[model samples]
Target: MKRQIIASINHNLGRAIALLDVIDSKTYQDTSIGPYYSSIGSHIRHTLDFFDCIISGLDTNDIDLTARKRDEVISTDKDAAKDHIYKIQETLTSYTDVNTDYLIHVTDNMGQGKITVNYTLESILAHANSHAIHHYATIGYMLEQLGVSIKIPGFGYNPTTPVNKREGI
Candidate 1:
């Protein structure tokens, strides 16, 4: 189960790299570097931030972390983004794939008097997958605003799309 789930996480990370490759490098660099939710690049950085945290948090429950910090943009340079993607992929593949019965500790940010839950590491992996989708949509919107379009692979071949649909009639 852990191996299968970890593979899915890495695959999503690969898709992000492929889709972003379709976007212009200059635009990727010139886009705003921000901590605000209004910025697209910030969202992408935010996704990577959690990727790092989850990778780390899988082992230690004591990392000083905040969700907002993950949302802040680290860099606008496409190379930086690519570097992050590669590093995070390395971490995910190196760690998650090997741990089968490892436990993950989950809690609300900032110790807000909420009960913490113990989950298998794969649940956190799924959270990152969901976040990647949201940020990918954000990037897709930002590209549209810049009059740039990415020929992303999964956007049209979804389960309901014609490319994925089969003839039954």
Candidate 2:
């Protein structure tokens, strides 16, 4: 299960890297798309920040989801965002012996107030994986709006989504 989880994350991160390779700096930082006016870089940074929180809090056993880097450079620079993604991939690679079932405290604000809840390391990783995909889908929309043709297969889709639906066939 741990191997599968890690592989899935690495694959998704690879897709992000591929995207960065193709898009220019302007497209990465473009915020002219929608009602919220969020850039692709912002979504990428936000997704990575979640993983950063997980990786940073692993040793202490207390993950704070609200503690995000929110780095402007990462949000405005394609190279910086790619570098950050590479760093995250390398860090995840180093955790070869993590126990998936280990319980840890996770702090996040779901609504009215901040709350800390117990979660298995596997569960949180799984949530983060899904979260990344969700952000990727948003990025896909932005890319389409910006007239960038992305060819990376399954780049912004959940594994369980039907192929026909993903391709609009």
Candidate 3:
């Protein structure tokens, strides 16, 4: 199970690195999209922030979802984003054999106030994977609006998506 979870995280990190190969800094940081006006880099950085929180909290078992680093360089610089992705991939790879059966406390602010919830390491890791994929789909939309071509065919798809659907049936 840990191996599978780690692989899923690595999969998204690989896609993020591949994205840098196709997009330049200007498009990466472009926030001129209409309506919500979110930049691709913003989504990418946000996606990474969740994983960062999990990894940082692993030792202490006190994961705080709202305490994101929100590194500006990662959001605006393609090279910085790539470097960060590589670091995350390395961290996840090291956790494959670690015991994840213990409970982890997760804290988050849901508009009204802060709340804490109990979670197993495995469960939160699963959430982080799902979270990254959700943001990747948003990045997909942002890239499309910016006229960027995706080199990875299933970069943002859910793993449970039917194989035929992913292949366009």
Best by TM-score: 2
Top lDDT: which candidate number? 2
lDDT of every model, 2 decimals: 0.62, 0.87, 0.84
Q: Write the per-residue lDDT of candidate 2 for residues 1-169, one digit (tens) a residue.
A: 7777877898889999998998899999888998889999999999999999999898899899999989999999888888999899888877657555678999999987889999987788889999999999988888888888868888878889998766410
lDDT of 1: 0.62
Q: In model 3, how large is the Cα lDDT of residue 71? A: 93
lDDT tens readout by residue for model 1, 1-169: 7677778777777776775566555666445433333554565677887777676665666322254355233446555777788888887778644644856676655456645666667777776677777676666666666677666566312224475452211
TM-score for candidate 2, residues paired by index: 0.94
Residues 1-169 of candidate 3: C-alpha lDDT, one tens digit per residue: 8888788779867888887888888889899887788788888899889989999988998999999999988899888888899999999899998877878999989898989999987788889889888878878777777777766867778878887766210
Give candidate 3's whole-model lDDT: 0.84
Candidate 2, superposed: residue stretches over 4 Å from native: none
Shift of residue 131 alpha carbon in model 2, Å: 0.4
Model 3 / residue 169 / CA error / Å? 16
Instruction: Give the clash count for model 1.
Output: 0
Candidate 3 ranges beyond 4 A from true positions: 167-169
**Residue 11 local lDDT, model 1:** 79
